[model samples]
Target: MIRLVCSIVAIVLCVWKVFNWAWWKPRRLERYFRKQGIRGPPYRLIHGNVAENGAASLEAKAKPMNGFTHSIVPRVLPFLHQTVQKYGNLSIFWVGGNPRVDIMNPDLVRDVLLNKFGYFTKMKPNPVVKLFVTGLVSYNGGKWSKHRKIINPAFHHEKLKLMMPAFYTSCGELISRWNKLALEGSFELDIAPELQSLTEDVISRTLFGRNYQVGRQIFELQTEQQDLLFQSSQFAYIPGQETTATLLLWTIVLLSMHQEWQEHAREEVLRAFEKNQPDFDGLSHLKLMSMILYEVLRLYPPFPLLTRFTSKKAKLGEITFPQGVQVGLPILLIHHDRDLWGEDVGEFNPTRFSGGISKATKNKVSYFPFGWGPQICIGLQFALIEVKIALTMILQRFYFKLSPTYVHAPHAVLTLQPQHGAPIVFCKR
Candidate 1:
């Protein structure tokens, strides 16, 4: 009996090894990259580059990062930016033994996102992520189209205009609280949770037409999901599929960091209102809110990375990708890539988007904060207005700065977030 058990164990180990070598080798797609004359660090077996990527992420999170030098994309994918630096525009990397080709050329991106989106769909997702976030952000093909159509009206200009009052109310409450704090002398508040509460309030009131109680629950659940996902350390998950996890990572991180921006935005809202005395309906008509929406989406996109999968044989630009290969859009990487956005690519310059997104990049496929093509974010306009109304009202009264206890460590746990907490000081203006 002991010998029988030992034999079974031996057989299982051998079979697993064979499968890893023959089917799941990280370099299975090496030939595809080689055909395109792209070079990359040699792929590691089974683990590929994921272990090193994880280590590098830990290192980045251990210290404060200079905005220009702090690379959120490379931290998530590791060795990818270095590969691009060495291999030029097109390159390949692995995500846990899965081959994902990274294409930075705007023309190639345009071809894939615009001309041939049907050929690529969302990456094969983890079963766990498919549970929580089952919204349009994760859908593809016909299902994607249907969801997009249904969600479109939520973001219509008229609908957004109606939602403007909710934004003002939430922001007003925050400012009023700060006013009381200022009167009491030293009031140290953590801005991370505060802004989160603010955004939650907006999403709740506008999305569900109630207070932020439900949105707050969703946000708290998402925080738990973030922790669970990190323990799993798996990517290529479905949208809103992670149950308690979230898909909007980058926006959270940036809002946590730019405390001063919050203050400036509040001032802008007040100034606009004072100059025009726009009521809720009138405030919705304010152009400054529109500009702020564009700027924030550009600077701090919620989902920084977009992943797609190829089924059957498909041609993307000069390279032909055989079925079963995953492609990463690296939206944030493209947004900040110096080649696409001049030397100030890494700089937080909202002026670049002053003329609107289409004009921002000359119709290039680089600046898709809510994604593009048929697979574009269904809630793009909804998310933006939710943010806009929230910011406008908050800015009406308070000044923000980095909290004294704030630690500058941003990490990706589903979405980018402050590893410690978003410690921000709110001053009543």
Candidate 2:
């Protein structure tokens, strides 16, 4: 009788714990936010707002974007955009059992990133993401710092200068292929896959010490590796290539849309390379290209959403957040914020960055394409150098415009990508 009663008590306690975790705690947190005068879609059960969020995402993708407008917040992040539009900027929302407080104010974002309250910590990465993406991206605190220190020298500018030949070689192959397509006057081609292939090759050669030019024999051998992942350098390749490729693609499309800017960029590239093939010194001096790239990053940043978790009670601005709550910093929304970026926030104005990023942003923590604070992307310099080399080479040969088959839909699946492939007509210059 005693043993049976003890077993029943244990079972009862377990059930109560589950109930508290799945429902009660969430409601308590929800009420706390509500008391603070914050509003959002009400949390529902264990799923929270997941079902409604999914439905909104599907609805947004029901059709491609109608017009090629730079104001892409509605299309890319529909639910969050709608939430902000309805409940104001500083609002509350739920992600599963945790309350997510969406903070749009730049000062608040800077505070969260800088972890000013000493209560926030890095969000645990998704289990599926952990399977593939490794290294500095997945770490926080001391471990991330140690890993960053280990890889720091490889991405330094001087090291990248040594890799410029590899950059030029990979870009040369891409230019060669495109030159063939353009040889027969103007040609229509989907530039997305071509750019993806170019970035993959560039990463493979410079970082992996092997390229497709090395032939299929070694490729076959690599497929049989014992303990290693697909490639040791895949950590940098996946994230870096996706960002650089998308940046270059949009740079082409945006420039095609604005021909005068394209002319300006072409002139800059020509001046930089007037003596011979591009060198590190010459590439660094291409200020106009840098402005255009920064503008592209502003308009279509790769990592659209940055989320941080509170491990303990925290405060931002005037509001106090409870433990286990996630704070969202939607990069897209902040980048498009009219109050922070002035009236032309949605418009493509590279000249805003002509005075440099600090001046352009008024020295606020506003512009962070590669992120801010201690955890900024380590491969930022590598991505920049690779893309600049490729862009400089391309502008020297071809003038491109979006093909009629092209669609202007930009959506985020982890990173921002054109919904339809970037079909473009490349005319030989």
Candidate 3:
């Protein structure tokens, strides 16, 4: 029996290697690009460019680096820079044996996102992705359309009014905790964890309409699943990975790093909530909360990478890609691009969203925090309102700051999140 098991294991390993070497080598795609006069680094065996790209990513996270050395190009995939730098702005690269063409020009991006969308489709939803945000963020075509229709009413201005009280309840909890801490003389505490807990609680009560304890438990479990998924970094894994925990971890990391923005956002939230008690009917109409939602989506989209697949041949400028390619649209890179948003793009400026999304994108097809086209995020409205309501209430009652132990390193297990758990201290203002 043992011998049979060994034989099966050996056979599986052999078959896996054979498939990777024969069919999945990056060279298979590289040669095609070379034939078409496009240039990229010669593909190495089965690992392809992953090693170099991983190394670059590790280096970038270790210290501050400029875009030229550690950026969307090289850190995302090895030869990413080489491909674009050598072949000009239009180039192709591979990730784990799949071909992906990067179209940096805004015009081509617009065409793919809007004009020629029929040819390209949202990336096949990773099975893991389906678990957490099972609502609309991962759906496509008919199902996505149906869910969107069902969910539309939830995000409407009037519906948000129905959610404000839930937000206030969650926020009040955070405030009470902070006030107790402040009474003990705590100040300059990390706010990320507190905010995350507050948001989770708010989402629980508002969406599930369940008792706060039940909702909080559900959120806590989901958060644990998120964290498990992140630590495993298994692109394909069981659906049970702790998603909620991981999301909370990343949220804390991101919010803590930008301390100044934390203060600014805190001030805004306080102003909004102090004027009202977060009453369900009245506070939903608050414009400041809406602006906060837009800003948070911009600075830290939940899914940093927007992936899609091609159903047929697609053309972006002079380059044409065959079907079955996985296209990754990195929101982090696009959102921070200097050309897209001017030199101040890296800075967190909520004012940019003052004129609303249309004016913010300058009528471009960019800045899709939820996504784009017919398959935009379904839970987007739900998520945004939850964040706004919770933040507004917390700010009215407490102050938060990054803990001294905080570190800045954002990566992807499934969504864009911090490599380390966000550790924050909280105090009442």
Q: Name the candidate that leads on TM-score.
A: 2
Measured against the true structure, the TM-scores of the candidates, in listed sequence, are 0.78, 0.92, 0.73
Stretches > 4 Å off in candidate 1: 1-28, 66-78, 115-117, 164-173, 214-268, 275-296
Better of 1 and 2 by TM-score: 2
Could you give candidate 2's per-residue lDDT for residues 374-417 as a string of tens digits?
A: 67888888888888888888888888887888889888876788
lDDT of each: 0.60, 0.82, 0.58
Question: After superposition, which runs of candidate 3 have C-alpha atoms over 4 Å from their true positions?
Answer: 1-28, 34-39, 64-88, 115-117, 126-135, 187-193, 211-275, 279-296
C-alpha positional error of residue 408 in candidate 1 after TM-score superposition, expressed in Å: 3.1
Which scores greater on TM-score, model 1 or model 3?
1
Task: Write down the lDDT that model 1 would get.
Answer: 0.60
lDDT of 3 by residue, 194-224 (tens): 5555555665566567544695465445555
Worst 10 residues of 2 by lDDT: 224-233
The order by descending lDDT is 2, 1, 3
